[model samples]
Target: MSTALPQSTGVIAEYRARLAAGSIVFDSAQASAAERLQALWAKLRGYDPHPKAPPNGWVGRLLRRKQVDDVSDHPNGLYLVGDVGRGKSMLMDLFFEAADVPRKKRIHFHEFMQDAHRRFHAIKRDNPGINDPIPALADLIAEDAALLCFDEFQVHDIVDAMILGRLFEALFARLVVVVATSNTLPDDLYKGKPGRDAFLPFIGFLKQNLDVLVLDAARDYRRERLHGLNAWYVPADTRADAAMDHVFTTLAAGAPAQPGSLMVSGRKLAVPLSVPGAARFDFAALCGTALGPGDYLALATHYQTLLIDGIPRLSPDNFDEARRFVTLIDALYEHRVKLYASAAALPDDLYKSGEGAAIFERTASRLEEMQSDAYLQLPHLT
Candidate 1:
């Protein structure tokens, strides 16, 4: 209802506005979590993230200003955890949008890690003798933002898991406040994985640095939304395209889709439409390119849900593209990434006969299963 931003704006107020307008139904769990975020929002008001410098002379050096102001003593942040569609990210986004911070960023955790590794390597390459780049990376990030918010916070790569503890510890020490939304709790992170013992300390450190709130809302709102639409659309018509657009908008919530990059080995693969834990792509962009299993795997790993547009009928004439589509489906199926697409034909009818016919059977079967309720209910495997 308000057209302008105000200094006193808070997440609770925004949530109530949306609730009143019927944009969202009020769940007690979401309301309680909003209160916690509101508390943090209040603490963050008028809180300066920049460190003050002492006089820049011998006296300053003598004083050594060992401390960089009181940034390190800033308030602890909040960590929101819940099942998918429980509104953990929604609430976090509300707080991030309304917070009155001069320097702040809200990013998906996957892309953050990808950039982290890239920067970490660059730092090491630039400074050959620098053994640890985590502190430097943290400092670099802190200079840009005193507040960082992450969506779909998750860790599966051993490399990322190893570096996270140090990276985040340094970030906290620099007075950077972090807010994250995840489907898992702090302790369950990297659980059952090898080298998990070393990761245990990081989990404990995270718990200490942030207040964790669980939002086990009674309904699966995201699933409920999906239930109203057919997961796959046939004939690739204008109506199908409109429906695809709606699906993408609904799943992305209020986050804007942006052109993003995925690090595959050492190469950067371009993602045309990246929306937090979801991505949208035209069939040509995905299957017509010279991409391999590695590229598709990277896509599957990054986006839990994919909205694809204009998947043409597969046949002998476009055998290469058809094969690539099969590879893409295989990767998505393996990762349990939910798919929504506009296609020229149903999965079975799309690949009726050709050189790819034999192997296409598996892909067709997987596509059908992917559209089923049982498959949609399964959690994506990282």
Candidate 2:
């Protein structure tokens, strides 16, 4: 009988060290994010599926060459849902960053929707000959990676509600495994909006393709840390220079909120300047304008933090305006933006009118997201 040669312990130790340090760049060409993800899948597939079991210990399985699932067939498509600050996003980030996949793309859900909307319009205007953009989009995704991850998956805007089908169809067509974390269940997204019933098909598609898992521990991780007065809302104490100084100092430490109007596809936003440490944005005028998802998307890309005041009422015109406001805040939050807001009342109490209760629900959810410990940890002043 042929005997296997003894493995060198020194070499094995070196290999482990290299892997831990991320110095073992698996053949860049071969061990792509997609491939790395497949490696993880291979490792996972070999493990016992039972609730209680030890790690995989089969030598034969280890010796055999494993097949990584194509983008479409990867077995671990995931849907993680829970209340804010319950570590949903942190878990997603860990999975996306550590899991080996041949090609991997982790997109903030809001940003992705904004991007999809932007591309759809661009394609429509530029290539009118193409009846549908889904096919081309699918091909592009297929070429890039076999895995995709999204953080804070949500659907609120008319634009998002309209394109859910085409976007998912393209992504799913490529056979890419999707991992998404959301505050809302897939079925409950955009629940109360007008014509929301139309989105059922997309929800059905998600349910069929993804394994939904809920991490519903009631404890709000965000609120636990914010229990005391230390984190409560506090406006800048000093007037004029102190306020502006605090704003500038706070903003400069994080992403610089450059004083410039943002433009998206010919739309212009006139940004007001702060004297030294204060913001110049006219909240009334900004909210009063024709606000929509597009406007928020533009602001999100440019500013990581926003402070808005003077919200008298949260009516439909106000709700629609605030919807964009919420979308912008969501987008910024997805990008890890710091937000500080002051209104006549708290978000939950902002709009308590007839038939407009839905806006309050959305507002409460957004406020929770903003107050999450992860968000709070970002540089901010009260």
Candidate 3:
């Protein structure tokens, strides 16, 4: 089997070509930031074509040689913070793809922390006497990835906030360069949280270890795309399905949808199709099942946009499903998640004859409001 060749031009050049070709809107600030990141990538790639192994045992040295080059002339990593839809994630993606490195991994920050928690548990299980497993965990990660790119870096969980300082300290010590994108600045991370003072050191550590840059673009690209477009498409049909598919693909930026699961209060909620920043689901997979407010809230928090297909007319026969749908809408509404759905009827016509028909009126109102420009302009709850 033959392998595919990487692109010859740098990331900034490629981005400029896209702008020239009208594939993407031109934003001067975003382009400038991409140029800066491209410089960093060039420095990183130029450091060592052939790395020498550490003075460990033969097996250890061999493993190290296979993973990363020498830790010489490594540049400080990047912390790109920007407003929602300001092209931060898009720039990071380009940087990750263009970087020439033997070992690099790009992942969402929430997923990274989940994996970190699982690894911590496993390491703790094996090394029972160790008081801290973070160093060993960081070593394992460094063995596989010298460059770590994280998207949508938001700190919401206290468990993560408490451990990040020590964990990142160890990773930096091992020369694991990280590039991350977030909506909040380093100083604003975990703001207004209880015991947030304990999380401050991690913020300082991040500031010292990474070159924080802001993508100061004024336009929200996502909202611009949504302008005058119908967020809710009724009479779910072949045309509506195709339109929904196009919208999801556009929002996902060519990333293929993957199957994922969300753990909500000891229950596993299956997501049929998902890419970073968006998810697509069948109405039955969500409302026909026994999902609750917590499950929908978790989904709203995770994805900026949710595309639901095959929303059917509700009746007394499927009262429970209708009730669940109402709760799901409420959760999505509260979180300001952009909702796109192909439905059997208009929101008002969905639940015409149900015991909760009066309550369904509120859900219908919220659904209509969610499609409005005001709701589309609201920032997503992370």
Candidate 4:
């Protein structure tokens, strides 16, 4: 490692410069980790006693080496596990800034899945040769010394669970090293998921190739930084009233702003432009149109209250969505958000198919909460 950075360090030097400018305050252990990584980078680049590797040729090698897995070469992959706001991204940003691999890519876990799923179906028609795009994409990634970094790596969906095994198998088989950060441990990545047993092979694959590392050495980093931070709202603030008024008026309009239409599993759902209602549009129309977990998630995330003109007669598909909907609602409820619904039947009566009655009983608590005036009277979430 050199005290002076070589001019050829190029993009790596610029990334280090940004790291120097970031508002990160590392503690003793983390500071030592950074120091060790930096020292390792110095050793690999053969830059002698130079100050910080001149932020150029010597510095860029650190990021480039992350994608290189050869035993005779620099170390591959970095596992930076910790709670949020621990400067995981900050540390990685320095590495990314210096990385010169043309194929280098980083994506948030949720966002990455959205893209992968979208492209998987979209490209199928054009590239019929590629039955599944995820594995193909992984193979493409293995082509160059491109670094693939995923933030917030937690598996949640059946689609991801089904495909992740093949994707990772092809990736690791091609010698691609992944750098990921997760709140859950590697073995516990998709714990408690429905049909999770089907994904065990991928879990086994990850355990074999990826190293699990925990970065938190003290209290939660987010809590430590915002320990005494206070939230203040002025008496004159009218934002709450405005949001409520919008929801009421929108519901009064009798339909969603955009006409709802989605093709799911060869079923076409065409919702009317409007439904007769005072406080909300037709909930049956909305929920009936939803064909997958994503639709239910979108509904829960966007609307707090749903008033159905007709009580849904639950079917197999509807039952599955309802179960998933309950999970989404529970997550939102845990986050202190509220849900309000008008249904002809109660939770015990809402099932036509599904064996998770015990879980549904727990979910019934949330359904009860939705009927409470506290949730129903609140302004719509923007």
Top TM-score prediction, candidate number: 1
The alpha-carbon deviation from the true structure for residue 224 of candidate 2, after best TM-score superposition, in angstroms, is: 1.6
Regions more than 4 Å wrong, model 1: 1-8, 51-72, 252-278, 291-298
* Order of candidate numbers by TM-score, starting with the best: 1, 3, 2, 4
Model 3, position 116, has a per-residue lDDT of 87
Writing each residue's lDDT as its tens digit, candidate 2 over 1-382 gives 1142322222233334445676433333212323333334443332221121113347423321132123333465778777655545545554565544557788766657666777677777889898988655654555565667877787777778878876786566545567887778988888999878788888887887777777664455444433431211333233433443454444332234556665566677766652212243545666667766666555654443555544555667566666555565556556455455545556676667756677467756767667666666542211
Q: Report the C-alpha lDDT of model 1 over 1-382, residue by residue, as the tens digit.
A: 2343532368888999989887789899999898889888877875556544335478755433343355456788888988777878778989998887778899878878888988999999999999888867876887778889988788887998899998887787668898998888999999899899989889987998888888989888889866788899988999999999999888876678899898788898998987767898999999998999999988987788998999998889999999899889989998889999999999999988868788899889999999988898776765
Sort every candidate by lDDT, greatest first. Answer: 1, 3, 2, 4
- How do the residues 1-382 of candidate 4 rate in per-residue lDDT, one tens digit apiece? 3456653354335434545765444365555445444533443342211122113266645533443334233234656777644556545555554544445567655556665676567667669787567655654445543456776576767888887798777666445556676656777767888888888888787777665556664544433433332211112125423433344444333234444443333345453332211223354445444445554443443333333333343545566545555655565454333432344456556554556655666666775675554544332221
Candidate 3 lDDT tens digits, 1-382: 0132322366777787778877688788997897788778776773332243344579766755544354344568999988788888888988898787788899878768877898999999999998989967877777778789998888988999988888997777677789999988999988999879999989988988899999998699877765566778878999999889888877866567899888765578889999878889999989988778888888987888999999999988888889899889988988789999999999989888758889899999999898887788776766
lDDT (Cα atoms) of all candidates against the true structure: 0.84, 0.56, 0.82, 0.51
Q: Kindly report which residue stretches of model 2 are placed more than 4 angstroms away from their true locations once superposed.
A: 1-72, 230-382
Number of backbone clashes in candidate 3: 0
Query: Of models 3 and 4, which has the larger lDDT?
Result: 3
TM-scores for all candidates: the values are 0.86, 0.51, 0.83, 0.50
Candidate 1, overall lDDT? 0.84
Clashing pairs in 1: none
User: Cα miss at 333, model 3 (Å)?
Assistant: 3.8
